[model samples]
Target: MPVIEVDGLVKRYRDVTAVDDVSLHVEQGQIYALLGLNGAGKTTLIRMLLGMITPTAGSVSVLGAAVTAGARSAWARTGYLVEAPVAYPELTVRENLELVRRLRRLPGGTDEVIERLALAPYAERRARTLSLGNLQRLALAKALIHAPDLLILDEPVNGLDPAGVVEIRTLLAGLAHQHGTTVLLSSHLLAEVARLATRIGILHHGRLLAEQHADQLDQHRRRHLHLGTRDDTAAERVLQAHGYHPHPAPGGGLQLTDEHALARPDQVATVLVQAGVPPTRLLTEEEDLEAYFLRIVGADHG
Candidate 1:
């Protein structure tokens, strides 16, 4: 059975439909990413699935149990860090983990998690004294304290430094690889999500726009060619005439779409060459999750 399943889930707030009929499945031992901009309802969907909020329509299930009825015990085997976790300022790093251990009555020591997150250095320091980066590390340790089977993290890497980011990435990889955990994480950082997620789900305007295997998504978005031209406008016009709207790129080039475009690569190259464009300078751009994300969500600096 899939670790998590959402079928036609909907959550509405007065006049606004926060989540509109989103459905997806996450299999066991896979890292699934829920991605969207702020106010896109990714959080709402996650909250509903976790039983933290009530849905206006449809259903959600986690670990083969109905979300509403079985959430309390179903979540016992789950560990989550939502957005920036709130910890008591007076509590020390180790104290926070102790509190969680006692609250959940789970087995095992917290040392493994503390060491994994590198929170040992600040273990005795009060949570309020830690930097934002360190605080995030402490929160991560708390989430994994119980070593739950399923981990749900919302923006787990937020406020993390480069080193911290790499550490969390490695830790997450180990969670799925070594401990056999299923993870569903949400993030706005496409690059980080790309590295950690095995499957990706894209959300826009409170709906799932796309979902695919990470490698397949990359393959589907791979560029056919990067056409450089002395007359960039002419190159774009030529592409437009063939019903292709290539994304704009610097140095008078166009970012070609994948095979879905009507014009063949040879035809496109020939057209660019005929239009005084330098086909000699053509090169293929390596596909990444960011490219697929930008295409689906459109370009936004924020």
Candidate 2:
């Protein structure tokens, strides 16, 4: 069975609909990422999944159990980092984790997690004194302290620097690949998610616009052949004569979306050179994830 499941989920706040008819599933050991802009209901959907908020319509199931308020069993095997990390201002890092250990009745000491998250240096430091990056790490440590079977994170790397971001990514990937832990995370960082997530779901205007396997992203990406020559008009004319439609690119080059042209850029170079317009630049460009995301969202709004 899928580790996480949402069926026709909907949430309404008075007259405003926050999420509408959304449904998705996450299997064990898979990293599923939800991408969207601010105010796109990503947080609201996550809240419903964690049973923090009741959905107006639809159902959520985690670990083969229905998600509802006070579903202790379901929550016991789950770990989450939602929004900003919060800690008692006066509590030291180690003390905060110790508190979580006792509250969750977890059967382990805080030493392992402290080392795992590289918090030993600041273990005795007060939460109030930690930097934003360390505070984010503390939140992650809390979520991972119990070694839960599932993790649901919202912008887990928000306050992290480049190295910190890479560290957390490796940790999450290890958990999923080595331990079969399922992860569902939301992030606005398209490139980061593209690197870590096995699948990606795009949300917009409080709705799911698209969902696709991350590995298949390249296949769905639009590819174009870029050609440049000393004589732009001649190159364009040559392409047209060969029944290929060319468009002007922003960088004073010609772009062709024809499948045959994209497939055989070498042929394009040959044609251009044979026409005495020897190509100055000939390359095939595949749209990156960020560009693809913007294109998709733009089309949705258009």
Candidate achieving the largest lDDT? 2
| Per-residue lDDT of candidate 1, residues 190-265 (tens digit) | 7888788899999988889988877676556655567776777777887788677787776556777656443467
lDDT of each: 0.82, 0.93
- Residue pairs clashing, model 2: none
Error of 1 at 183 (Å): 0.1
Instruction: State residue 261's C-alpha deviation in candidate 2, in Å.
Output: 1.1
What does candidate 2 score on TM?
A: 0.96
Give Cα distance to truth, residue 186, candidate 2, Å.
Answer: 0.5
TM-score of each: 0.83, 0.96
